[model samples]
Target: MHSRKIYTNTKAIAWVTIGTALFSLIFASGKFADGSASPLQILFLRYIGGLATLLLVVLVRRERLSAYRSPKPLSHFIRAVFGASGGGALIYASANMPIVDATALGLLYVVFVIPLGVLVLKEQLSSQHFGAIAICCAGAAIVMASRGAFTEFHMAYVFPAGIAVLGAALLAVEGLMIKMLSHSDRTMTVLLYVNAFGILLMAGPAAMQWVPLSFESAISFILLGPIAVTAQYCIVQGYRLASLSIVGPVDYTWLIFAGLIGFMFFGEKPTLGVAAGSAIIAIGGIMLAIIKPPAGEHESTSSA
Candidate 1:
């Protein structure tokens, strides 16, 4: 029993980590598609890609079409609304701002998730988890402030940065909804519905603004599908296997990954602040992996 709990917790951390890295790239890739397409168009293409990948997975498994049906249709709808809009906002902000700054701002959702989870889902926030999250947030503060890493805030970016915050808040609501869905839905079912609904939601807006894409931008958006499938699948499974408070801060890793990827692909330079802050963030991530949530309830629910 002890071993089983450890296994699920371990798997949860792995899923969130891998998914977050891939998701960072998905957002970073938004930078390429910016001018070539509107945020809606980019997001639409990405969803189309995600749904396509999911269907292929279904085909490979030879799963019945029925496997996609979920019991929580309204729940999924709310999640989709949040997912589509929040995602579009993030892409819009990412397209407009430096990738690291946009992402760090977007992570404001994780901070909100704890209280939101408590109020909405009645999830416990362990002291250990809260402390780790604080550490991560402190690191995030440094990342967002560092001249070498984050772009200095200017009134010029006020709109998109504000949009980024709105996006984070919406995604936080979406996270609570996902926690409810994860109680019963299969990971693929969770993602399939989100992509299906998200695609439907974006199609009209995206169509209105569709524009010709460069070869590079075209490939980048096309790749969003597989990345979406891989990342969302891992994340759903992680959520299924762990508590919200425990797994939510694991998202801090995305900020770190975004910083590095932004440096390589977007020419952002890193300095001592970036190095030091990231290390502190890494410590928090380690805390998440090692710290157990209150044992009994987690194990009780997890064994199912």
Candidate 2:
């Protein structure tokens, strides 16, 4: 049993690592599409792709449509709203900011989770968690403040930076909602609803922003959904295979993968402040991941 548990955890870490890398690729694809598509357009394509992929999964598994129904439809709707908003913001930043910086900043969701856990999940708050949150916030500020020194201090950068931070907060809310939804909803059910609602909400803006895309860009846009869906499944499986304390830090590998990809593909380099800030934030995130809540306290371990 002990060896089996170890093997399972090792497999989980591998899956999470792959998932994180794929997530970086997904963001990179968004960055690539930035020139040819609007954020809404990218979001719409992602939603369409994700919805299609989930539908296929449901069909292949011979799962009834009703199996996707959630007891908490309202919670799913709220989760979808936040998920779409956060996703839109993330893609916006991907388009406007360096992939490494945007990816690092995106990790701030882990920081936001602490306070949100307290307020929304009713989880106990400890001094250590508060200290970690403070560190994380400071790191985020440093990353944003350092942006001007490396890049131009223009609204172009400012707007996306603000949106990225907001995206992190919104995603934090989604995490809380997912915690609640997990009790009664299957993973696929929650995902199916979120994508369905996202598609519905984004259709109007996506239609308005629609521009003719080259074959290559269109293919890239279509690919986002499969990539995203696969990544989400990998993350979910990873978490299911192992405890958060074991696999959580592996999720941070996304930033590293982003940094490597940005350098190779976009010739992007992080400034000293960006590097320092990201390190600080990573430290805090790892600390939070290792924290063990008191028995019976509802801690969020969802990687999605």
Candidate 3:
């Protein structure tokens, strides 16, 4: 049992590292896309690339699409809607904001997921979790305040912020669904459905806004899709090997990487307030992750 636990912890760290790196790549790619493409065009390319990569994986594993035959097609559809919306929001934000700022806001999904778990999944919430949420909110506020993100009131800022909130909600729902499906479905299958359905669903809106893609933009789009896929896969693997609370907080490490990448590539620097707030948020998340709720206590609240 001790050996197993140690192995699980190692896997968790690996997942966190891999997941963070891929996400960082995704953010960096988004920054790249912003320079040359529209959000819709980027979304279309991402999905197309994701779909192609998934198809190749399926073929290599000889996994039949029939294997993904789900009785809950509606659930898959819902997941797709949330996933697509989240993607659109992130891409939109990346186009307008500095990559780090966009990523910082996007990380709010961690805060959003906690309440979602409590209310939707009927999980219990502890005081520690509440404290964690509070900390994360404070952090988010700090980042926003430091960046003067609220003062501008421009579409670029406003739109992505809205999307970030929406994305967090969607991701919370996705977590519940994943937990439910974990009983019978493999993570790959769940991921595959989400990606495939997301591509199909987003294609309509994306097509409406479509512009012709250049060779450079096409490559970035393709790469973005695969990076996202790989990140999700790594996350799933991490979850499979350990408890959610253990692996979840490590995901927040993305902010650090985002900050670094933003500085290195875009010459964007976070202000003291943003840095301090991000630290608070990271601490709160870490506290929550390491805390084991009392037996029979839920880890979220109804208002989450």
Candidate 4:
């Protein structure tokens, strides 16, 4: 039983890791599209891409339109709003600031997840795990603050940084919504609604900032659909496979993925503060993953 549990967790972690790595690419793409497209435009194209891919899959599989129906339409709408706004905020923030810092701010969602997990999902895990989460958030804040030194003297950058924080909180709420919706809807169904709503919510804003894309840029924008869909799919699957307490910490991997991509592709590098912060985060994550509950108590683990 123990071995089987380990395998299940390992698999869940693997899926989520791939999803987050791919998610980092989305962040990078936001930066890549910065000068070429507004955040709304990018979000619109991304949702269109995701919706298109999902439609193709449904057609290819001969899926019934009924597969898209959900008992919780309002829930789906609310989640979509949160997801779209949160995503749009991140895209804008990513464009204005370093992708790594934006990514770090996004990582703050995991911090909010613990409390929400307890309140909404009723998740029970080790106190150590909760502390570990705090550690990771502190570290991410340090990383963000360190990179923030680049703008330490620049006052214009402050608002975008604040937007990033808002985005993270919204996303944390969206994550819990996903958990709630998963109880009543299929993953594909949930995704279909979110993407469809994403398009609708972003349409007006996107149209306001519309610009014709070059051939190369058009191709890249279209590709955003598949990447976003797949990444979201994996993340949803991870939640289905493990408790949020387990999956939330792993979400911190976004910083590592973002930092590397920022350095390799954007010629950005982290300062010493980033290194120190990341080390603390690493310690916390390790503790979260490996530590056991005290005697006679086990974590409240659930599959969904």
Q: Which candidate is the best by lDDT?
A: 1
Q: Which stretches in model 2 have alpha-carbon errors above 4 Å?
A: 1-20, 89-108, 127-166, 234-255, 270-286, 297-304
Q: Note the residue pairs that clash in candidate 3.
A: 115-304, 124-298, 124-299, 125-298, 125-299, 125-300
Task: Give Cα distance to truth, residue 31, candidate 3, Å.
Answer: 2.2
Per-residue error at 251 for model 2, in Å? 7.8
Per-residue alpha-carbon lDDT of candidate 1 for residues 35-137, written as tens digits (9 for 90 to 100): 6667677778888889888889889989886967887888898899998889878878877887667877888888887788779867776887778889988
Q: How do all models score by TM-score?
A: 0.87, 0.72, 0.76, 0.84
True-structure RMSD for candidate 3: 5.4
Candidate 4 on 34-131: residue-level lDDT in tens? 67876678778888899999999889989786877888888899998888889778878877977656766777788787689878877767777778
Query: Sort by TM-score, best first: what order?
Result: 1, 4, 3, 2
Query: lDDT, candidate 4, residue 168?
Result: 91
For 110-130, candidate 2 gives per-residue lDDT tens digits of: 667556656764666567556
Off by over 4 Å in 3: 1-21, 89-111, 153-167, 238-254, 296-304
lDDT of 3 by residue, 88-156 (tens): 666666667665466567767766665655676565656765676666667766766676654545565
Candidate 2 — which pairs collide?
Answer: none
Q: Which of the two, 1 or 2, has more lDDT?
A: 1
Question: Residue 252 lDDT in model 3?
Answer: 64
Runs off by more than 4 Å, candidate 4: 91-105, 149-162, 269-283, 291-304
Error in Å for residue 59 of model 1 = 1.8
> What do the candidate models score in CA lDDT, each in turn?
0.79, 0.69, 0.66, 0.77
